[model samples]
Target: GNEYPEDLAALPPQIIIGAQYVQAAGVALGFKKKGAKNVAYTYTGDGGTSQGDFYEGINFAGAYQAPAIFVVQNNGYAISVPRAVQTAAPTLAQKGLAAGIPGIQVDGMDALAVYLVMSEARKYSVEGNGPVLIETLTYRFGPHTLSGDDPHRYRTADEEAEWEKKDPLVRLRTYLDEKGLWSEEQEEAYIEEVNEQINEAMKKTEQAPKQKVSEYLQNVFVETPPTLEEQIAKFAAKEEA
Candidate 1:
Protein backbone atom coordinates (compact mmCIF):
# COMPACT_ATOMS: atom_id res chain seq x y z
CA GLY A 1 0.00 0.00 0.00
CA ASN A 2 1.12 3.59 -0.69
CA GLU A 3 1.16 6.48 1.74
CA TYR A 4 -0.68 9.55 0.52
CA PRO A 5 -0.41 10.06 -3.27
CA GLU A 6 2.67 8.96 -5.20
CA ASP A 7 2.63 12.29 -7.10
CA LEU A 8 2.81 14.21 -3.74
CA ALA A 9 0.62 17.06 -5.02
CA ALA A 10 -0.59 17.73 -1.47
CA LEU A 11 2.89 18.25 0.03
CA PRO A 12 4.28 21.45 -1.45
CA PRO A 13 8.00 22.27 -1.54
CA GLN A 14 9.47 23.71 1.68
CA ILE A 15 12.84 25.36 2.29
CA ILE A 16 14.06 24.91 5.87
CA ILE A 17 17.73 24.25 6.31
CA GLY A 18 19.43 22.14 9.03
CA ALA A 19 16.28 21.72 11.14
CA GLN A 20 14.24 20.07 8.38
CA TYR A 21 15.27 16.53 9.32
CA VAL A 22 14.36 17.17 12.94
CA GLN A 23 10.84 18.12 11.91
CA ALA A 24 10.61 15.15 9.57
CA ALA A 25 11.71 12.74 12.32
CA GLY A 26 9.03 14.09 14.61
CA VAL A 27 6.36 13.54 11.96
CA ALA A 28 7.57 10.02 11.29
CA LEU A 29 7.56 9.25 15.00
CA GLY A 30 4.03 10.63 15.24
CA PHE A 31 2.84 8.41 12.39
CA LYS A 32 4.49 5.30 13.80
CA LYS A 33 3.26 5.95 17.33
CA LYS A 34 -0.29 6.19 15.97
CA GLY A 35 0.15 2.96 14.01
CA ALA A 36 -0.05 4.63 10.58
CA LYS A 37 1.23 2.24 7.89
CA ASN A 38 3.62 4.45 5.90
CA VAL A 39 7.27 5.23 5.26
CA ALA A 40 8.63 8.71 6.08
CA TYR A 41 11.90 10.10 4.73
CA THR A 42 13.90 13.33 4.54
CA TYR A 43 16.99 14.50 2.65
CA THR A 44 19.97 16.62 3.68
CA GLY A 45 23.27 17.53 2.05
CA ASP A 46 26.72 16.52 3.32
CA GLY A 47 27.27 19.86 5.08
CA GLY A 48 23.89 19.71 6.82
CA THR A 49 25.03 16.51 8.54
CA SER A 50 27.44 18.61 10.56
CA GLN A 51 24.57 20.49 12.19
CA GLY A 52 23.65 19.38 15.74
CA ASP A 53 19.95 19.19 14.91
CA PHE A 54 20.68 16.43 12.41
CA TYR A 55 22.07 14.11 15.08
CA GLU A 56 19.36 15.03 17.59
CA GLY A 57 16.61 14.14 15.09
CA ILE A 58 18.10 10.80 14.13
CA ASN A 59 18.81 9.92 17.73
CA PHE A 60 15.18 10.58 18.69
CA ALA A 61 13.88 8.39 15.88
CA GLY A 62 16.26 5.53 16.66
CA ALA A 63 15.43 5.67 20.38
CA TYR A 64 11.71 5.24 19.72
CA GLN A 65 12.21 2.84 16.77
CA ALA A 66 10.36 5.34 14.54
CA PRO A 67 10.07 4.59 10.83
CA ALA A 68 12.11 7.33 9.16
CA ILE A 69 14.59 7.23 6.30
CA PHE A 70 17.40 9.78 6.44
CA VAL A 71 19.08 10.34 3.09
CA VAL A 72 22.33 12.28 2.85
CA GLN A 73 23.52 13.29 -0.61
CA ASN A 74 27.25 13.10 0.11
CA ASN A 75 28.54 15.02 -2.85
CA GLY A 76 32.38 15.17 -2.63
CA TYR A 77 32.32 18.75 -1.37
CA ALA A 78 29.94 20.61 0.90
CA ILE A 79 30.06 24.16 -0.38
CA SER A 80 33.77 25.13 -0.24
CA VAL A 81 34.83 22.43 2.24
CA PRO A 82 35.75 18.95 1.07
CA ARG A 83 34.13 15.91 2.71
CA ALA A 84 37.45 15.05 4.36
CA VAL A 85 37.45 18.34 6.29
CA GLN A 86 33.82 17.83 7.38
CA THR A 87 34.62 14.69 9.37
CA ALA A 88 37.38 12.17 9.91
CA ALA A 89 35.01 9.24 9.31
CA PRO A 90 35.45 7.24 6.11
CA THR A 91 31.78 7.45 5.27
CA LEU A 92 28.80 9.46 6.51
CA ALA A 93 26.66 6.33 6.53
CA GLN A 94 28.41 5.00 9.64
CA LYS A 95 27.25 7.99 11.70
CA GLY A 96 23.81 6.38 12.06
CA LEU A 97 25.28 3.34 13.84
CA ALA A 98 25.78 5.39 17.02
CA ALA A 99 22.00 5.92 17.11
CA GLY A 100 21.15 2.28 16.45
CA ILE A 101 20.08 2.89 12.84
CA PRO A 102 21.14 0.71 9.93
CA GLY A 103 23.07 2.73 7.34
CA ILE A 104 23.74 1.93 3.69
CA GLN A 105 25.73 3.58 0.90
CA VAL A 106 24.83 3.80 -2.80
CA ASP A 107 26.10 5.24 -6.06
CA GLY A 108 24.06 8.39 -6.43
CA MET A 109 25.20 8.96 -10.01
CA ASP A 110 23.28 5.86 -11.03
CA ALA A 111 19.54 6.58 -10.90
CA LEU A 112 18.71 2.89 -10.95
CA ALA A 113 20.93 2.22 -7.95
CA VAL A 114 19.30 5.03 -6.02
CA TYR A 115 15.84 3.62 -6.84
CA LEU A 116 16.79 0.14 -5.64
CA VAL A 117 18.25 1.42 -2.36
CA MET A 118 15.18 3.64 -1.67
CA SER A 119 12.82 0.76 -2.43
CA GLU A 120 14.40 -1.43 0.25
CA ALA A 121 14.81 1.43 2.74
CA ARG A 122 11.06 2.12 2.54
CA LYS A 123 10.18 -1.52 3.14
CA TYR A 124 12.50 -1.84 6.16
CA SER A 125 11.18 1.34 7.79
CA VAL A 126 7.49 0.65 7.08
CA GLU A 127 7.63 -2.71 8.83
CA GLY A 128 7.53 -0.87 12.22
CA ASN A 129 11.20 -1.59 12.76
CA GLY A 130 13.13 1.69 12.90
CA PRO A 131 14.79 4.42 10.86
CA VAL A 132 17.37 3.76 8.12
CA LEU A 133 20.19 6.06 7.02
CA ILE A 134 21.36 6.23 3.39
CA GLU A 135 24.54 7.96 2.28
CA THR A 136 24.78 8.68 -1.45
CA LEU A 137 28.23 9.09 -2.98
CA THR A 138 27.78 11.73 -5.67
CA TYR A 139 29.26 14.92 -7.01
CA ARG A 140 27.88 18.42 -7.46
CA PHE A 141 28.86 19.50 -10.99
CA GLY A 142 27.94 23.17 -10.55
CA PRO A 143 28.37 25.86 -7.92
CA HIS A 144 26.91 25.20 -4.44
CA THR A 145 24.13 27.67 -4.93
CA LEU A 146 23.05 30.78 -6.93
CA SER A 147 25.67 32.57 -4.78
CA GLY A 148 28.05 32.62 -7.77
CA ASP A 149 30.75 30.41 -6.31
CA ASP A 150 33.54 29.57 -8.75
CA PRO A 151 34.13 25.81 -8.26
CA HIS A 152 37.44 26.10 -10.13
CA ARG A 153 38.92 27.69 -6.98
CA TYR A 154 38.76 24.38 -5.08
CA ARG A 155 38.61 21.69 -7.80
CA THR A 156 40.67 21.18 -10.95
CA ALA A 157 39.51 20.82 -14.58
CA ASP A 158 40.92 17.29 -14.69
CA GLU A 159 38.81 16.21 -11.71
CA GLU A 160 35.72 17.78 -13.29
CA ALA A 161 36.29 15.88 -16.53
CA GLU A 162 36.69 12.62 -14.58
CA TRP A 163 33.25 13.05 -12.99
CA GLU A 164 31.74 14.17 -16.27
CA LYS A 165 32.27 10.65 -17.61
CA LYS A 166 29.83 9.37 -14.97
CA ASP A 167 27.04 11.79 -15.86
CA PRO A 168 23.78 9.89 -15.17
CA LEU A 169 21.66 11.42 -17.93
CA VAL A 170 24.38 10.89 -20.54
CA ARG A 171 24.92 7.29 -19.47
CA LEU A 172 21.21 6.55 -19.36
CA ARG A 173 20.64 8.10 -22.80
CA THR A 174 23.54 6.15 -24.24
CA TYR A 175 22.16 2.87 -22.88
CA LEU A 176 18.68 3.68 -24.18
CA ASP A 177 20.03 4.55 -27.64
CA GLU A 178 21.97 1.27 -27.79
CA LYS A 179 18.78 -0.64 -27.02
CA GLY A 180 16.83 1.41 -29.65
CA LEU A 181 14.62 2.79 -26.89
CA TRP A 182 15.50 6.46 -27.36
CA SER A 183 16.42 8.86 -30.16
CA GLU A 184 17.91 12.36 -30.37
CA GLU A 185 14.74 13.57 -32.10
CA GLN A 186 12.62 12.44 -29.12
CA GLU A 187 14.94 14.22 -26.69
CA GLU A 188 14.88 17.46 -28.70
CA ALA A 189 11.08 17.56 -28.96
CA TYR A 190 10.71 16.70 -25.27
CA ILE A 191 13.08 19.49 -24.25
CA GLU A 192 11.31 22.04 -26.45
CA GLU A 193 7.85 21.15 -25.08
CA VAL A 194 9.13 21.16 -21.48
CA ASN A 195 10.68 24.62 -21.94
CA GLU A 196 7.43 26.01 -23.37
CA GLN A 197 5.41 24.60 -20.49
CA ILE A 198 7.86 26.05 -17.94
CA ASN A 199 7.64 29.49 -19.60
CA GLU A 200 3.82 29.42 -19.42
CA ALA A 201 3.96 28.39 -15.77
CA MET A 202 6.31 31.29 -14.96
CA LYS A 203 4.02 33.76 -16.69
CA LYS A 204 0.98 32.49 -14.81
CA THR A 205 2.74 32.73 -11.43
CA GLU A 206 3.94 36.27 -12.23
CA GLN A 207 0.32 37.31 -12.80
CA ALA A 208 -0.76 35.92 -9.39
CA PRO A 209 -1.36 38.32 -6.48
CA LYS A 210 1.28 38.83 -3.82
CA GLN A 211 0.78 37.14 -0.41
CA LYS A 212 0.77 38.93 2.93
CA VAL A 213 2.29 37.62 6.19
CA SER A 214 -1.02 38.31 7.96
CA GLU A 215 -2.84 35.75 5.81
CA TYR A 216 -0.54 33.02 7.15
CA LEU A 217 -0.87 34.27 10.73
CA GLN A 218 -4.68 34.42 10.52
CA ASN A 219 -4.89 30.82 9.36
CA VAL A 220 -3.23 29.55 12.55
CA PHE A 221 -5.87 30.63 15.03
CA VAL A 222 -9.63 30.00 14.77
CA GLU A 223 -10.26 33.43 16.39
CA THR A 224 -7.55 36.01 15.91
CA PRO A 225 -6.25 37.58 19.13
CA PRO A 226 -6.12 41.36 19.54
CA THR A 227 -2.32 41.29 19.64
CA LEU A 228 -2.15 39.38 16.35
CA GLU A 229 -4.69 41.81 14.83
CA GLU A 230 -2.56 44.74 15.93
CA GLN A 231 0.56 43.03 14.59
CA ILE A 232 -1.14 42.45 11.26
CA ALA A 233 -2.12 46.12 11.04
CA LYS A 234 1.46 47.11 11.83
CA PHE A 235 2.74 44.78 9.10
CA ALA A 236 0.30 46.33 6.61
CA ALA A 237 1.48 49.85 7.51
CA LYS A 238 5.13 48.84 7.06
CA GLU A 239 4.36 47.37 3.63
CA GLU A 240 2.68 50.65 2.52
CA ALA A 241 5.77 52.59 3.57
Candidate 2:
Protein backbone atom coordinates (compact mmCIF):
# COMPACT_ATOMS: atom_id res chain seq x y z
CA GLY A 1 0.00 0.00 0.00
CA ASN A 2 1.12 3.56 -0.80
CA GLU A 3 1.32 4.97 2.74
CA TYR A 4 3.57 7.92 1.81
CA PRO A 5 1.74 11.25 1.99
CA GLU A 6 1.75 13.82 -0.83
CA ASP A 7 3.32 16.25 1.63
CA LEU A 8 6.43 14.67 3.22
CA ALA A 9 5.74 16.69 6.40
CA ALA A 10 2.40 14.91 6.82
CA LEU A 11 4.05 11.44 6.83
CA PRO A 12 3.02 9.26 9.77
CA PRO A 13 5.15 6.84 11.79
CA GLN A 14 5.24 3.60 9.73
CA ILE A 15 7.06 0.28 9.21
CA ILE A 16 8.20 0.20 5.61
CA ILE A 17 8.63 -3.25 4.05
CA GLY A 18 10.15 -4.57 0.83
CA ALA A 19 11.31 -1.43 -1.03
CA GLN A 20 9.13 0.75 1.21
CA TYR A 21 11.15 1.12 4.43
CA VAL A 22 10.29 4.81 5.11
CA GLN A 23 6.57 4.43 4.52
CA ALA A 24 6.34 1.28 6.67
CA ALA A 25 8.11 3.01 9.57
CA GLY A 26 5.70 5.90 9.27
CA VAL A 27 2.76 3.49 9.65
CA ALA A 28 4.46 1.91 12.71
CA LEU A 29 4.74 5.32 14.39
CA GLY A 30 1.04 5.83 13.71
CA PHE A 31 0.34 2.51 15.47
CA LYS A 32 2.44 3.68 18.44
CA LYS A 33 0.24 6.76 18.78
CA LYS A 34 -2.97 4.70 18.40
CA GLY A 35 -1.89 2.76 21.55
CA ALA A 36 -1.72 -0.56 19.73
CA LYS A 37 -0.93 -3.54 21.92
CA ASN A 38 0.24 -5.73 19.04
CA VAL A 39 3.30 -4.98 16.99
CA ALA A 40 2.95 -3.84 13.40
CA TYR A 41 4.87 -6.35 11.30
CA THR A 42 6.71 -5.32 8.12
CA TYR A 43 8.79 -7.58 5.84
CA THR A 44 11.76 -6.61 3.69
CA GLY A 45 14.26 -8.47 1.55
CA ASP A 46 18.02 -8.37 2.35
CA GLY A 47 18.69 -5.80 -0.36
CA GLY A 48 15.92 -3.49 0.80
CA THR A 49 17.26 -3.71 4.37
CA SER A 50 20.52 -2.12 3.13
CA GLN A 51 18.65 1.15 2.55
CA GLY A 52 18.87 3.96 5.14
CA ASP A 53 15.12 3.86 5.82
CA PHE A 54 15.28 0.28 7.11
CA TYR A 55 17.73 1.18 9.89
CA GLU A 56 15.87 4.43 10.59
CA GLY A 57 12.57 2.55 10.95
CA ILE A 58 14.08 0.05 13.37
CA ASN A 59 15.70 2.83 15.45
CA PHE A 60 12.45 4.77 15.71
CA ALA A 61 10.47 1.65 16.67
CA GLY A 62 12.97 0.87 19.43
CA ALA A 63 13.19 4.46 20.69
CA TYR A 64 9.43 4.89 21.04
CA GLN A 65 8.82 1.28 22.10
CA ALA A 66 6.54 0.97 19.10
CA PRO A 67 4.81 -2.40 18.77
CA ALA A 68 6.58 -3.36 15.52
CA ILE A 69 8.06 -6.57 14.22
CA PHE A 70 10.63 -6.08 11.46
CA VAL A 71 10.92 -9.34 9.52
CA VAL A 72 13.82 -9.73 7.10
CA GLN A 73 13.42 -12.59 4.62
CA ASN A 74 17.05 -13.25 3.68
CA ASN A 75 16.56 -15.33 0.52
CA GLY A 76 20.33 -15.22 -0.33
CA TYR A 77 19.78 -12.84 -3.23
CA ALA A 78 17.89 -9.61 -3.83
CA ILE A 79 16.82 -10.01 -7.48
CA SER A 80 20.18 -10.48 -9.31
CA VAL A 81 22.31 -9.16 -6.42
CA PRO A 82 23.78 -11.79 -4.12
CA ARG A 83 23.89 -11.42 -0.31
CA ALA A 84 27.70 -11.15 -0.45
CA VAL A 85 27.34 -7.89 -2.41
CA GLN A 86 24.28 -6.75 -0.43
CA THR A 87 25.90 -6.09 2.96
CA ALA A 88 29.11 -6.85 4.86
CA ALA A 89 27.16 -7.58 8.06
CA PRO A 90 27.51 -11.26 9.03
CA THR A 91 23.89 -11.51 10.07
CA LEU A 92 20.88 -9.27 9.33
CA ALA A 93 19.55 -9.94 12.84
CA GLN A 94 22.65 -8.29 14.33
CA LYS A 95 21.53 -4.99 12.83
CA GLY A 96 18.63 -4.92 15.31
CA LEU A 97 20.98 -4.82 18.33
CA ALA A 98 22.14 -1.38 17.21
CA ALA A 99 18.55 -0.22 17.61
CA GLY A 100 18.38 -1.82 21.09
CA ILE A 101 15.81 -4.37 19.91
CA PRO A 102 16.32 -8.12 20.30
CA GLY A 103 16.95 -9.84 16.95
CA ILE A 104 16.35 -13.53 16.32
CA GLN A 105 17.53 -15.48 13.29
CA VAL A 106 15.35 -18.51 12.59
CA ASP A 107 15.40 -21.30 10.01
CA GLY A 108 12.92 -19.96 7.49
CA MET A 109 12.51 -23.45 5.95
CA ASP A 110 10.93 -24.65 9.21
CA ALA A 111 7.36 -23.34 9.19
CA LEU A 112 6.68 -24.40 12.80
CA ALA A 113 9.83 -22.69 14.06
CA VAL A 114 8.99 -19.41 12.34
CA TYR A 115 5.36 -19.56 13.54
CA LEU A 116 6.41 -20.21 17.15
CA VAL A 117 9.04 -17.44 17.19
CA MET A 118 6.61 -14.93 15.64
CA SER A 119 3.87 -15.95 18.10
CA GLU A 120 6.24 -15.42 21.02
CA ALA A 121 7.36 -12.06 19.64
CA ARG A 122 3.70 -11.01 19.31
CA LYS A 123 3.09 -11.97 22.92
CA TYR A 124 6.14 -9.97 24.05
CA SER A 125 4.84 -6.88 22.21
CA VAL A 126 1.32 -7.24 23.67
CA GLU A 127 2.92 -7.39 27.12
CA GLY A 128 4.53 -3.96 26.46
CA ASN A 129 7.98 -5.44 25.80
CA GLY A 130 8.46 -3.38 22.63
CA PRO A 131 9.73 -4.38 19.13
CA VAL A 132 11.57 -7.48 17.90
CA LEU A 133 13.52 -8.04 14.69
CA ILE A 134 13.26 -11.48 13.08
CA GLU A 135 15.53 -12.48 10.24
CA THR A 136 14.15 -15.57 8.45
CA LEU A 137 16.93 -17.33 6.55
CA THR A 138 14.91 -18.62 3.57
CA TYR A 139 15.64 -19.33 -0.10
CA ARG A 140 13.81 -18.21 -3.22
CA PHE A 141 13.58 -21.28 -5.45
CA GLY A 142 11.75 -19.57 -8.27
CA PRO A 143 12.68 -16.44 -10.24
CA HIS A 144 12.25 -13.08 -8.43
CA THR A 145 9.06 -12.74 -10.44
CA LEU A 146 7.62 -14.15 -13.71
CA SER A 147 9.86 -11.69 -15.60
CA GLY A 148 13.20 -12.70 -14.05
CA ASP A 149 15.24 -15.87 -14.68
CA ASP A 150 17.07 -18.15 -12.21
CA PRO A 151 19.84 -16.06 -10.60
CA HIS A 152 22.59 -18.54 -11.53
CA ARG A 153 25.00 -15.85 -12.73
CA TYR A 154 26.08 -14.95 -9.19
CA ARG A 155 25.10 -18.30 -7.54
CA THR A 156 26.91 -21.57 -8.17
CA ALA A 157 25.06 -24.75 -9.21
CA ASP A 158 26.45 -26.60 -6.15
CA GLU A 159 25.11 -23.88 -3.82
CA GLU A 160 21.69 -24.00 -5.47
CA ALA A 161 21.61 -27.81 -5.25
CA GLU A 162 22.59 -27.65 -1.54
CA TRP A 163 19.79 -25.16 -0.69
CA GLU A 164 17.27 -27.16 -2.77
CA LYS A 165 17.80 -30.10 -0.41
CA LYS A 166 16.61 -27.86 2.44
CA ASP A 167 13.54 -26.61 0.56
CA PRO A 168 10.66 -25.83 2.98
CA LEU A 169 8.03 -27.66 0.89
CA VAL A 170 10.25 -30.73 0.59
CA ARG A 171 11.09 -30.70 4.30
CA LEU A 172 7.44 -30.26 5.31
CA ARG A 173 6.34 -33.06 2.95
CA THR A 174 9.05 -35.34 4.30
CA TYR A 175 7.99 -34.66 7.89
CA LEU A 176 4.34 -35.38 7.02
CA ASP A 177 5.31 -38.53 5.12
CA GLU A 178 7.26 -39.79 8.14
CA LYS A 179 4.12 -39.38 10.26
CA GLY A 180 2.02 -41.16 7.58
CA LEU A 181 0.20 -37.86 6.97
CA TRP A 182 1.22 -37.74 3.30
CA SER A 183 0.95 -40.30 0.51
CA GLU A 184 1.14 -40.36 -3.29
CA GLU A 185 -2.65 -40.35 -3.58
CA GLN A 186 -2.96 -37.50 -1.09
CA GLU A 187 -0.31 -35.44 -2.86
CA GLU A 188 -2.02 -35.89 -6.22
CA ALA A 189 -5.43 -35.03 -4.73
CA TYR A 190 -4.02 -31.90 -3.02
CA ILE A 191 -2.39 -30.71 -6.25
CA GLU A 192 -5.59 -31.29 -8.19
CA GLU A 193 -7.69 -29.39 -5.63
CA VAL A 194 -5.25 -26.45 -5.56
CA ASN A 195 -5.08 -26.31 -9.36
CA GLU A 196 -8.89 -26.27 -9.62
CA GLN A 197 -9.10 -23.43 -7.07
CA ILE A 198 -6.39 -21.40 -8.86
CA ASN A 199 -8.05 -21.95 -12.27
CA GLU A 200 -11.42 -20.71 -10.92
CA ALA A 201 -9.78 -17.59 -9.42
CA MET A 202 -7.98 -16.87 -12.71
CA LYS A 203 -11.21 -17.30 -14.66
CA LYS A 204 -13.01 -14.83 -12.39
CA THR A 205 -10.17 -12.32 -12.59
CA GLU A 206 -10.04 -12.56 -16.38
CA GLN A 207 -13.82 -12.13 -16.66
CA ALA A 208 -13.80 -9.01 -14.44
CA PRO A 209 -14.04 -5.68 -16.27
CA LYS A 210 -10.76 -3.85 -16.73
CA GLN A 211 -10.39 -0.53 -14.88
CA LYS A 212 -10.75 2.59 -17.04
CA VAL A 213 -8.23 5.48 -17.23
CA SER A 214 -10.79 7.84 -15.66
CA GLU A 215 -10.92 5.66 -12.52
CA TYR A 216 -7.34 6.67 -11.64
CA LEU A 217 -8.27 10.38 -11.59
CA GLN A 218 -11.37 9.73 -9.44
CA ASN A 219 -9.40 8.40 -6.41
CA VAL A 220 -6.75 11.17 -6.40
CA PHE A 221 -8.98 13.51 -4.37
CA VAL A 222 -12.30 13.54 -2.46
CA GLU A 223 -13.42 16.23 -4.89
CA THR A 224 -11.57 17.36 -8.01
CA PRO A 225 -9.23 20.32 -7.34
CA PRO A 226 -9.25 23.34 -9.71
CA THR A 227 -6.06 22.12 -11.42
CA LEU A 228 -7.48 18.60 -11.80
CA GLU A 229 -10.75 19.99 -13.20
CA GLU A 230 -8.79 22.09 -15.71
CA GLN A 231 -6.75 19.04 -16.74
CA ILE A 232 -9.95 16.98 -17.14
CA ALA A 233 -11.48 19.70 -19.31
CA LYS A 234 -8.33 19.82 -21.44
CA PHE A 235 -8.43 16.02 -21.80
CA ALA A 236 -12.08 16.16 -22.90
CA ALA A 237 -11.34 19.01 -25.34
CA LYS A 238 -8.48 17.01 -26.84
CA GLU A 239 -10.76 13.97 -27.20
CA GLU A 240 -13.42 16.11 -28.90
CA ALA A 241 -10.85 17.73 -31.25
Can you write out model 2's per-residue Cα lDDT over 1-241, one digit (the tens) per residue? 2243333333333344453544555556666565554356778888778788888888877887777788999998888888888888899999999999999999999988999999999888657777889999998887787875767766788888888889888888889999998999999999999999999999998997664434445444658999987877776666557
Show model 2 residue runs off by greater than 4 Å: 1-19, 148-150, 182-241
lDDT score of residue 111 within candidate 2: 82
TM-score of each candidate structure, all chains considered together: 0.77, 0.70
Report every candidate's CA lDDT: 0.84, 0.77
- Which 10-residue span in candidate 2 carries the lowest summed lDDT? 1-10
lDDT of 1 by residue, 66-128 (tens): 888999999888888999999988999999999999989999988889999999998989988
| Segments of candidate 1 deviating more than 4 angstroms | 3-16, 192-241
Global lDDT of model 1: 0.84
